[model samples]
Target: MAEAAWGNGELARAVNRTGTETGQRLKYDASAVSHWLSGTSPAAKALPVVLETLARRLKRPITAFEAGFREMPTPVDKSTDTVSGLIDLGSLDMDPSRRGILTAGLYSVALTIPGWPDVVGRFERLRTDPHLRIGMAEVRAVAAMTERISTLVDQFGGRMARPMAASFLVNTIVPYLRANADEDARKAMLSAAADHCYLTGYMAADERHDSLAQRYYLKALELAGHAGDHLMYCTTLRGMSVQAVNLGHGSTALRFAEAASSASPQAGPRMRAFLTGQQAHALAQTGDKAGALLHLRTAEVAMDQAESKAKAGGRYDPSSLAYHVAQVNYELGDREGAIRAIQHSEKVRPMVYRGTRVRHRSMLAEWQIEAGRLEEAVQNWHLALDDYLAIQSGRADDRFRSMLSATRPHRRNPHVRELLERARPMAGGRGSARTAQGAMT
Candidate 1:
C-alpha cells in the first residue's frame, strides 16, 4: 500500500506531512513501513495517519479492519451495499466493546472521497422491489418521526437519541424501502428514508462516531438521489463538508461545500444562505480570510432575502446562520466577532435546544479564554458545565474536555483549580486532566 501510494522515500514524507497537519511530529521512515508490513502494528496514533494516507491516495474510505489491523465481519449484500453498511455500522456503534473502533482518528479525511456524485447517479437508476406494499402514510410517519427525533437530539444529545434512530432505520425504514409501492409513494418513501438516515448520520457524528456517520451520510445521499430530491442531496453533501471541516481537512471541506452549492443552483434564498455560509467556513479553514469574509457577507445578504420572502414559513433558521458566522469568525481569528455571532445564535436559539445552548456557552467560554479574560472565562465555563452535566452528548463531552485542556495551564489559579476538581468525575471514561496531558504527549 505504501509503495502503491508513494514511490521509494515518498511514503515517509507523506506520513510526515499528515503528522504535521495533525499536530504530531512523527519520524517514521521506510524502516517503519517494512515493520508494518511484517506484522508489527503501528502505534495507535500512527495507525490512523497511515490509514488516512492510504485512503487519501486511494480516494475512498479505509478502515483499520480493511487494513488487516483488526478483524470484523463484512456484510453480504452487494446490491444494497450502502444499506448493509449502515446496518453493520449501527450494530457496531451500539456494541460497547466495538464502539471504540468508530472513534479512531483521521477517518474524516476519507469522508471527502470524490465518488459520491457517481454513487448518487448510479443509485438513481435503481428499481424498487415489487412485492410488499407501502403507502403515503408510512412515508409521512417516517417524516414525522424524523421531526421528533430532531427535537430529541437538540434537547438530550445524540448519545441518548442515536440508538433510537439506528433502530428506526434498521427496523422501520429499511423494511419500507424494500417494500412495493406506487412510483410516487416509493419516491416519497425514499425521501423520508433519506431524511431519517441523514438524521441518524448526524447523531452518529455528534456522538463522535465518524466512521459510522460517514457511511450513514453516504447512504442518505444515495437515497436522496434515488428519490430525485435535489434539496436533500445538497443537504447531505453539506453535512459531509461540515464533518470534513471539523476534522481539519480544509481543501477537501471546501470541495464538498462548493459541490453542495453547485448541486442546487436554483435553491431558495434560505438554502442558498446556508450553503454559502458553509462555503465561508471552508474558506476560513483554508486560510482564505478575504474569501471567508466575502462569503460571510453573501450569507448575511442571502439570509435577509430569505426572511423577506417568507410568505408562510421560513426554510432557514437565523440561529444556524449566526452559528456559521461565529464558526467562520473563530476560524479567521476574530474572537470578538465570534463571540458576537455566538450571542446572536443564542438569542434566536429555541428553548427546546438545550444541547445547542450548552455548546454555545462552551464556545463563548473558549473565546473568553482566548481574549485573556480568565475570571470571565471561568464564570462562563461554570455556566456551561451546569448545562453540560445534564446532556448525554459526546459533542458536549468534547467541549468539556477542551475546557479541561485549555484550563490545565492555569490550574494553579484558585478558580481554574476549582473548576478542574469539579470536572474530574464528569469526564466520564475519557479520564481526567492528567490523562488529557498524557495523550497530548
Candidate 2:
C-alpha cells in the first residue's frame, strides 16, 4: 500500500469497487484496512479481491503469502491422491451453496507446471472397493458419457453442463476409479477418467472459474500419467495453454504451449495442428512475430493434412484454425485481418458449436467496433444476441457486458440505442472483459 501510495480508505474503496465489478458486494473502509494492518485477516472470499486490487495498483502478480495470507496450494502436490482430490473438488463444484467459493479463485500465473516425466507413471495406491469391480465396459461407458457431456457443453454452454459433469464425476466416475479391475481395464478406466476430468476443467475454464479449472487440470494430468495415456496428457497441457492465453497471460501461455508440444514427440497432424495453433497464438501475444508466423503456417499445413475424427483433440478443424488465425492477427495488431479470419471462422463453424458461435460473433462485433465499422458491428452484435440470450455462460456474459460498454458512446445511433435497451435488463451480471485486458500488460 505504501509503495502504491494508497491510503487506507483509498485501498478499501478500490477493493469494494473491484469486488462489485466481479459480482461481490464488499463493504470495506479505512477501519478494515487498519485492522488488516494490525494483523487481522480478511475473509477467504474477500482475500482474492484485496490481492487483486493490490496487484492492479502495483502492476505485478501478488500471491496470498506475499499479502500476509496463507500460501496458495503448491502446484501439483505429489502426495495428494488424485481420486480423493477429484471427489472433494467435484462435490464442492456440484453444490450451489459451495460453488461460489470455487469461482472466487483467481488465476495464478506464478505457479510452476509439472513436467511430463515427473507425472508419467506417478501414482500412489488408493483405496479400492474390493467387492465393486469394473471392466472395459465401464471404461467405455465413462468415455461415452463424457462425449455426450462435451457435445452439450459445446452447444449450450458450461453453465448448465458443468453441474452435470460434477454430479456425474462425483456420483459415477469416482466409484469407477475406486473399483477393482484387471490391469489393462484399470489403465483404460484411468485414461477415460482423465479425459472426463479434462472436459470438466475445460468447462470450468469456459465459465472463467480459473483456479478451480487449474485444480481439475492438475488432477487430469495426474490421472493421465498414472494411466500412461500420453494423448490425454498432452491434450490437457494444451488445454491449460488455451486457458492461460484466453486470460491474456502471454508468457505463461507460451510456456504451457511449448511444454505440451515438447511432450508429444509422435503427434499426428491433427494433434500437431491442435498444439501448434495455440503455440502460434501465444507466440503472437508474447511479441515473437517470427516464431508466431512460422508456427501458424505449420499449423495451417498440418491442419490441411489432418484426418477428420470425432475424438478429442482431433476436433481442431478448419474453423478452429481460422479462429486461431484471428487471435494471432489481433495480437499482432492486424484488426482487419482479424475481423476477416473471425468471419471465415463463423462461416465454417459447425452448427453444434452454438457456444463458440455466440463468442465468435460477439468478438467479431468488438473487432469491427475497434475498426470503426459501427453499422457492421451492430449487425454482428444483433446476431450474437440471437444466441446469447438462450445460453448460460460466463464468457458470453463477459461479451454481453462488453457490448453494453462498447456501444455506450454510440447510443445516439438508433440501432445502438435499441441494442442497449434490449441489454439493459441484463447489465447487472458478473464477468469483466477488463480482466482479459489487464493481463495484456
Candidate 3:
C-alpha cells in the first residue's frame, strides 16, 4: 500500500518539516518507499539525497543502489522521503562567480511583473532577425556592462546589487539571446545572461540561503550548456561543489568536484586548476588527510599554472581566493593558515561585499577558537550569529551548533562561558544581540 499521512495533518506537517530540514520534498505515496525497500531503486538522479534522508530518519547509514537495492528487503513506514528528482547535471560544482543571483532574479521578477510591460518589443523584434548583423562592439559592451553590475553588487549592498544585475540579464543579455539569429552570437549572449544568474546565486550563498543559492547555480549551468561555454559550465559546477562542501554535504560536494575535474580539460587553464582545488577541499572534509594533502599539492600545481598566464580569464575573485584557501586549511586542521587567509581576504575585498565580510569574519573567528584565542572566537561567533539570524540561514544555524560542539571542551572556561551568555537572547523573541546589529534592511 502507498504511504499515507496519519490524522490531523500531522504526517503532512512532518513531511514538510523533514523536507525543509533535509533539503528535499517528501513523496505522498507510501508504497514507493516499499519499492525502495525491496530491490527496486528510486530514480537514479536523486537516489543519493533520498538515501541520506531515510538514513537520517532511521539513524543509520543507507547506501542506495549498493548491492542492487535488494539487501534492504523489509517494508517499513516512510517517515521521511527526500526529493531526488533534481537532475545530477555535471556542472553543479563550479566557481562562486554568480553568488546571490537567483534571490535577485526572483525579487526582480516579483517587482517588475506588477510594474513593467515588455517595453522592448520593437527592439526585440529587430535584434533576433537573421538579416540584422550585430556589431562585435555591442557584444563586448553588453558583457562589460554585466561585469560592472556584478561589481556594483559586490561594492554596494544587495538592495542595489539585485536590481542592477537583474536589469542587465533582462535588458542587454537576454534581449541579445532572444534577438540574435546567428547561432554563435545567440550562444554568446545566452551564456552572458546565464552568468548573471550564476553571480547572483553566489550572492545567495553569501546571504547563507544555500538551497535557494543552489537552484540558481544549476540554472546558470543549464543555460551555459546551451551556449556551449564549456569553461563556464565547468566553473558553475565547481561553484555548486564548493557550496555543497561549505554546507557539510561532503560526499555530494566530492561527486560534483569530480565531475568538474573530468570536465576541466575542455575548460581553460584557470578553471581546470580551480576544479582540482575543489576536490582537495572535499577530501579534506571527508577526513582523508593523506588524500587531502595530495589533492592540495595537486591544487597548488594547478594554481601555479592558472596564475602563470597573468591574463585574467575568469580566475578566482578576491573573496573566492580567501574562501578557497581557508576552506582547505580549515578542513585539514590548519587554523593558522585559515587565519592568514581570512586576514588577506579582509584586506582585498571592498566594502561592496558587506555580507561577504560577515562570513569571512566568521571563518576567521573559527580559526581563533582553534588557535586557542577563545575570547576573540566568542566575539566573532556572536557577530556571525547575529548576521546569520538576520539572513535566516538554517545552514549557518547548523554550523553554529557544530562550532559549539567543537568548542565544548572549553565550555567551563570563563571566556567561553561569558561569550555564550552574552550571545543569548531575552526570551519571548525580544532583545537578541542580533537585534542590536540593527535591522538587516
Candidate 4:
C-alpha cells in the first residue's frame, strides 16, 4: 500500500486548499498515514479517505470500511450514522436556534453513536481517547478564524497562513461535519460547509484565481441549498455576481445581484441595499449610469434603514460596502463620490474579510490617482500596500497584469504603472511564516 499511501497524502493535499483557512486536515507526523498500510484501523469518520485510499491502492472501487480489507474495518451502519443525516436535519430549521443545535466540544467529537452513554464516557475520558472529536465551537470557530485569516491574507497579500487556513477548512470544518452531526445537524452543517466553500472561493478570488473561485462559489451555493439559509445562499450568489463582474460579465453580475435581492425574504433594508449596489455596479459597467445610479440611491436608503435597526446572525456583511460603492462611482466618473465611498468602506472595516482587500484598496487608489489626487493615491496605496503585503507572497497574483492585458486605454497611463509598481512588494512580501522563519535566522 506504499503506492496507496503516497496517493493518500496527495489526495489529502489536493483537498487541503490553501486560499481558504485549513486547520483540521490531520497532519500525522512521519509515517502516520503509513499506519493504514500495516494492520491499523481508522475510527469512524476517517473512512472516507481510508476507503478511497485503499480503493486506489487496490485498483478497485473500495466500499465500506469492513470491505476495506485487512487492517481498517469500518463498523456496520457506522457511515449512515456519522454525519450525513445531521447535515440534512440542521438544514431544515428556519429559526437559527431551532435550526442547528450545537453539540458541546465534548460530544461534538465523541458522540458518534445515538446514545448518551458512549458520548458521556468519551467526554469524561476525552484526554485518554485515541480520537478526539472536533467540538461544535471548533467547527464554529472555523467561521470566525477564516475571517481573521482572510484579513491577514488581504492586508499582506496571500501568505503562509493561506495554506494553514485551507487546512483548517478541510480538516476541521469539512470533516467534522462529514463525521458528526445528525439529520438535524446536517442542515446546519451544510451552512457551515457553505461557509467553508465561500471562504475558499473568496480567498481564491483574492489571489486572482477566478476559476478556483468559481468552483468554490458553486460548491458554496450547493451547500447553502442544503443549509436552507436563503440569505446565506443569496450572499454567496452575490459573491458569484462579484466574480462575474470581475470577469467582465456585467449581465451575469446583474443577474446574480437581482437574484440576491429577489431571493431575499423581506429584502431587508441593508441586504437589499448591498444587492442593489451590486446591481448598480453591473449597470455602470454596461454604461447604464442612470440605472446604476437609481439602484445606488435605493441601496443607500436601504442601508440607512438597516443602520436604524438592531439585529444579528446572517446578514450581508457591510465590509465591502465602500469597496462596492467605490467601484460604481469610479465607473461613473464620479471622482469625489468614489473617493468618499472608499473612505466610507474603511469605516466598516470588516473583521472577517480582511484577508485580501488590498486589491480593492489598490483599485481605489488607482482612481484617486486618476482624479489627479496623486498625493492621496500615494497615501491610499501605503495602506493598500500594507494589506497587499499581508497576503501569502506565492498567492499574491499580479492583478495589474490583467489590467494591462485588457485593451483599456487606462493601462497605458503613468498612474497605472505607478500603481502596479507599488503593488509588487505587497504582492511579493513574505508571509508571516516566512517572516518569522527568516527572523530566526
Tell me, by lDDT, which candidate is best: 2
> Higher TM-score: candidate 1 or 2?
2
Model 1 per-residue lDDT tens digits across residues 1-441 = 743557535777777777664457999888887776677877987877877877777767677788777767456466755556556766766667886666554445656443435655443324455676889999999999999999888878888888788778777887787787878997898889888888888897787666677878878888887788888889988988888888777877898899899989899888888899999999999999999989989989988887887472443578888999999989988889888988888788777788888877887888988899889888878888887766877778778878877887887899988887777666655422234444232
lDDT of 3 by residue, 263-304 (tens): 656665556557776887888898877877787676666556
User: Candidate 2: how large is its RMSD?
Assistant: 5.2
lDDT of 2 at 9: 97
**Segments in model 4 whose C-alpha atoms lie over 4 Å from true places:** 1-159, 311-319, 347-357, 393-441
Candidate 2 stretches with Cα past 4 Å from truth are: 1-79, 307-313, 424-441
- State residue 68's C-alpha deviation in candidate 2, in Å: 5.9
lDDT of 4 by residue, 11-93 (tens): 44432322122223544433544565465655544544445444534444565544433445545564433134323333321
Give the TM-score ranking, best first. Answer: 2, 1, 3, 4
Task: Tell me the lDDT of candidate 1.
Answer: 0.78
Better of 1 and 4 by lDDT: 1
Displacement of the residue 397 alpha carbon in candidate 2, Å: 0.8
Please, what is the whole-model Cα lDDT of each candidate in the order they appear?
0.78, 0.85, 0.56, 0.55
Residue pairs in collision within model 2: none
Backbone clashes, candidate 1 = 1
